[model samples]
Target: MRIGIVGTGFMGTTHAKGWVETPARITGFCAETVAEAAALADQYHAKAFASLAAMLPEVDVVDICTPTYLHLEQVRLAAAAGKDIICEKPLTLDVETGAEMLRVCEDAGVRLFVAHVVRYFPEYAAAKKIVADGKLGKPGTIHLRRCNYRPKKAAGNWFLDDAKSGGLLMDLSIHDFDYARWIAGEVKTVFSTTVGSMDKDAPVDYALTILTHEDGTLSHITGGWAYPAPNFQTGLDINCERGNIHFDSVASAPIRVLIREEQNAPDVGLPASPLAESPYTTELKEFYHAIAQGEAVRVTALDGLKAVQIACAARVSAAEGRPVFLEPQGGVL
Candidate 1:
């Protein structure tokens, strides 16, 4: 599949590399700024365009790597141009725009995929499989930690602006939100605590949310861009009825997985593959196949929506100091 990427920022560049590494062919890249587009195109060995309109006709797929506020319009443009879409997480900064994006893509008969990278992480994927196979017993409670030191360059930028990026819950914690849902099933309610970002006037950086899933599972997530350093960490611990498992420090090599029973200490497994490819590459390959076959994508627009909804609910719960329900629609439980 021929693909056109919009935006030449960090995520844009990362996704471009991922697509190139995947089976799809990179047709071109477009950035609002011509210089950025040209630079990325040169690096990726693809054509460069000054605008989305210039690249749409030449590519079968449009990958949106733009900021949150720009997603709705860019997606609409791609949809109208009859190109499949692969968008970054938190499809848009708000629910209405996100829903509209899905609607337009659906109406245009274009597949919509979101980049929820953690879902593709090898350790997380293995954890999900183990849980599905009942090896983790009945998933009872989960504790997750996802955090990073915000780059000084990005600390007070548009990413921190609630109106522009929807702050930390939407911009960052959404990953953890998606993973929690993926592993444990539907979320029923949440109570949260949040603090304004250290460097910005907006609220994008810090939060701790406690989620209650419909299956009587409790999950907790803590995320932020306030580390003030370059390192980042992510891990999840699952406590089941009969056993427990943990996947920790997955971003680096030798990812660890710990398993234990009621009477045992634990068994730890390290990375088995010496040269494992990145999860981003795997995710894009899946997107290519899903689009080609007109099949449901691994990271569907609804999954993105559900994640955003949970994040928004968490935000409300945080601001109000109360638990918020992940309400059923149309009286359907």
Candidate 2:
């Protein structure tokens, strides 16, 4: 399979690095400018195209790592050209646009994959496996934290634009929102509150959202763009009926899963395998093979849409200062 990347920013570079290690050939790249694409292409030993239209015919997949606002148009073009798509997260700025991207891809007879790469992270993947294997009875509560320095770029960068980037919740917090849905079942209700981000020009922002999962599980998710640059961390804590699972990026150890299946049994700590492979590479490899060989991956288009729906709902809850309820729309939301 040949892959064409459509951005040269951090995510685009990160995804490019991942794709090179996979079975797919890094055919070429195209960004807002040929100069940027050429730079990334030169480093990765691939060709660079002046436009998406020019590059479509040469690659089997279109990997979109552009900003949140550019996804709809780029995805429409890629799907119309009959190329499978790998869009970086939040799918699009809103549920309506994201759904349309899916519809366009479906009508074009191509696959639409969203990169919710957190699912492939070693620690989170391990916790999910424990829950899936039912070794911890059932997950009852989860707390997820992700924070980093606010993105900076040219004067009018879209990162801070609420209408364009969906602000912090849609752009940053949605990772844990998707992971929460992955660990538990679907979300039933969402209540959220935020600070500093509502004005769209705040120097830093923080948001806390509480999710009530359909299966009686609850997830408390916190996201921020307030940390100092080079000072970032993400951690997950899961409390289950039989035991507990925890992982902290700053923790000086592997993921610790404590199992206590019996009423009086001693708690046994099992350390998972250290993350040897980049989750980004694992994600791209799974996506590459799924496209090449028709296998199922950890994430799907519906998962992407559901996550965006939940995130959009969270934004509404925060803006309206009320709880928002969600009803799954048969299959699509």
Best by TM-score: 2
Local accuracy by lDDT, each model: 0.79, 0.86
Which 10 consecutive positions of candidate 1 have the poorest summed lDDT?
264-273
lDDT of 1 by residue, 1-333 (tens): 899999887778778877877778888999877787998888878899989988999999999988788888899889998888999888987666777888899999877899998888887888888888986588888988887755333333666567888877888889989999998888899888887622346423678999999888999998866553434667789889888888667455464445553432111111223445767778888898888876565567888988888888887887777899877643322
Q: TM-score of each candidate? A: 0.88, 0.90
Q: Could you list the CA RMSD of all candidates, in the order they appear? A: 7.4, 8.3
For residue 292, model 2's alpha carbon misses the true position, in angstroms, by 0.9
lDDT of 2 at 73: 92
* Candidate 2 lDDT tens digits, 147-234: 7767776566677778788988998889999999999989999999988525645677899999999888999999987876644678
Candidate 2, number of clashes: 0
Backbone clashes in model 2, listed as residue pairs: none
Q: Best by lDDT, which number?
A: 2
- Show pairs that collide, candidate 1: 167-204, 168-204
